[model samples]
Target: MSIKKSPESWAPNADQDLGPVLILEPEEGKNFWQPQPANGHISVRISPDFLDVQTPFSLGTQTLPAGGYVREHSHPEHDEVLHFIRGTGKAVVDGEEHAIVPGKTIFVGRNRRHMFVNSSQDELHWVWFIQPNGLEHFFEEIGREMVVGGEDPTPFPRPENVLEIEARTAFAPQPADQRKPD
Candidate 1:
């Protein structure tokens, strides 16, 4: 099967003229990951900026290293769906733990705390979508851009104003008991 390109390409350039369509190779999208202690990264494939739409959703891919995890957190205004693509892991959502494997889809409703922990030796990969858009902006504020692909994974220093950013986005943090493994 072959995929057809859109009538107009929307890739950004210095000129900043908006195009009718945006065509992006996987690598062309903005890439970012949580700094240290968070354990994974994401490649944002589509967002409002990328699509030039007022839609309230964003799409991206994430990879979690073995033994790595995303700390428990919640989006007060958005719901999230995670579709596992590779490897094995576990998702803790709202105090319940569930296995994560290829083809499994996890739904995290708004204000429910959740996190993903990679358990297999291999990396756990998944595609994620969040409703009401704007999560991309949070990622951009909290993460540094991966300028080049396949670079060595290193800890990114936590930004001093992360709490402020999180507050602005209503990204509530879970309590320590809720976030830690039982």
Candidate 2:
């Protein structure tokens, strides 16, 4: 459904030439989840592909179950910001550990190795944004499909093609050095 521009209506400005503004609720975006171990779900709020126009950044929410953690990985070509919304956890960025709490924000530069660990028994929920695209597609490719309000999918192993997906999605190869991981 394309929005039509009328005398009173509006469209992308010529000077800006950017994607439309998006206002989304917590669960209003496409969601995906890890199968067994991580149990983390990514709900995409906005992206270039989602907005159908090239944008400078993408926004999403990340939920990590108690004991679940986002594995250490980095986007060698993009910067990222993570804001903790709820729950307790720790984020290790560039080998430095920091407490994850509501209202806390972390900025990770390109090629920085980082991961989140849910230390408490409660679930960890946070919002993540990445610039210049990629993370949204990465989550979609690596996680099992999850509908907005659908029941969780059955536990499953990470896709065999996950490494290839990561590579194409601009993730710094595992170990941050070796091109082909064993």
TM-score of each: 0.81, 0.82
10 residues in a row with least lDDT, candidate 2: 1-10
| Candidate 1 residue spans exceeding 4 A from truth | 1-20
Candidate 2 positional error at 110, Å: 0.4
- Model 2: per-residue lDDT, tens digit, 1-182? 23323332354455544435556665567788776557768788877775665556888888888887777888888999998989998888777788888899999999888888898899898888898788888888878778767887746678888889999985988884422111
Per-residue lDDT of candidate 1, residues 102-173 (tens digit)? 999998989898888887899999998988777778777887677664675556666888778877764876
With candidate 2 superimposed using the best TM-score fit, by how many Å does residue 176's alpha carbon deviate from the native?
A: 7.1
Which run of 10 residues does model 1 get worst, by summed lDDT? 1-10
| TM-score of predicted structure 1 | 0.81
Instruction: Please give the distance, in angstroms, between residue 102's alpha carbon in candidate 2 and its true position after superposition.
Output: 1.2
Q: C-alpha displacement of 153 in model 2, angstroms?
A: 2.6
